[model samples]
Target: MVEDYRTHPNLAKIKIVLVETSHPGNIGAVARAMKNMGLSQLVLVNPKEFPSQVASVRASGAADVLNDAQVVASLDDAIADCQVVVGASARMRKVSWPQLDVRQTAQLAMETVSADAQAQVAILFGREDSGLSNAEMDKCHYLAHIPTNPTYSSLNIAAAVQVFVYEFLMATDIKSVHQAEGYRHQLASAEQLEGFYDHLYQALQDIAFLDPSKNARFMRRMRRLFNRSQLDVKEIDILRGILTAAQRQSNQLKTLTQDRD
Candidate 1:
């Protein structure tokens, strides 16, 4: 049974997600790549056009993946239950975020998924032209960068999927003694993490730290910072408690000032 399961490592964990794919051909190609690597979980978040004949033709023999693909309204919806999210990018952005090579990211993901039976790992690919936006990238716990020719680093979405999936499959084959021991820390659930962000945001608002007018930009940056940290459940709980305390203090201070006045 283990061998059978190992044969389809992608089936056990790992969701291949494409966000806002503009081309159906890329979608089909991604499906083909997933099928090639024994990956069946293909998720498309708001594709420009899906179920197109062009996609089917490009999919070649991987029509099953295309047919079974989950179409979600947003990237968050696609990876809501996922424990680990790795975004693929070819270019470096203005923001300095932690980066991982494909192999390292795969190893981390495999470790995460294997440790927790309920864990769902998501590998996200952005639009073909722009790649993953900063917002989309912020949603991921880690960033996976493919080492291509610097001059011509533009990789097709399907090609990017192939690289990551291949590494993931290879990582799964290795029976590590460490994996048997399980993860050292408990990673926060998506819901928990989101709640922490909410509390943190509210605390910032209460303290007048984040300008209400620029709240959107401020929250976006904060999200990216926290996501990159990949906080565990304990870490998130601790942070939430801290934020709660800060909010309470801020409220108390406001009350005292008003009473004094």
Candidate 2:
């Protein structure tokens, strides 16, 4: 009966995304790893070499996963529809994201899927050498890490994906009570959040708050704030409405000052 976990419907809602992978073989390896763990959704963002024979050869029997993998031009396009985005990282950034361990990340993924059928969870793996850039990480709601030796902690990208895939399979074994079925609202997608952030930034600039060149990290901090909140669609609309109101007020004040001068 435990083998039934292989056919779990929620697994289909989880997307494993690779960002700018340098080696085609690693993509193939990740595909194989995903298939082995009963997860199939794979997305590649700007891989250096793909649709290559090397990848097909490495995929071995799991060529089906490779064949179906989505190739996208940018990280945004890859994760635009996902409601929850988690970045796999080895090092913490200066502006720390809420970090999750491998097992916890799988739990979060499962909970998100259990809550909403339309929602997708994207687990992002970054470049082999640099991992995810600051910009890519900004799109993530959380950063997840595999516990490794503090002295020597780097992992091959495929290996990290395998670890996560295995954990995701293990997550299926948990009792159904742990599922987050109580969450009823449709959580905001990554693209929607990006739009709201842009509006909020423009409103900030309209009121003479943010200076992008000088205070570049300001928006990053703001992203961290809203991302952790896990805003829903309606919440985003409300916040954007507030920003619009503020922007309109700022414009009217500026017009008044100009008229007086």
- Model 2: residue 90 alpha-carbon error in angstroms: 2.2
Tens digit of lDDT per residue, candidate 1, span 110-161? 7676666677888899988888887777677777788889888788888888
Q: What is the C-alpha RMSD of each candidate to the true structure, in Å?
A: 3.1, 2.0
TM-score of each: 0.86, 0.93
Give one digit per residue, the lDDT tens place, for model 2 in 87-204.
Answer: 9997877767889999998888887777777989999999898999988888999999888898999888889999999888888755433244455678899999999998988899
lDDT of each: 0.81, 0.89
TM-score, candidate 2, is 0.93
Looking at model 1, report the run of 10 residues with the lowest lDDT sum. 1-10
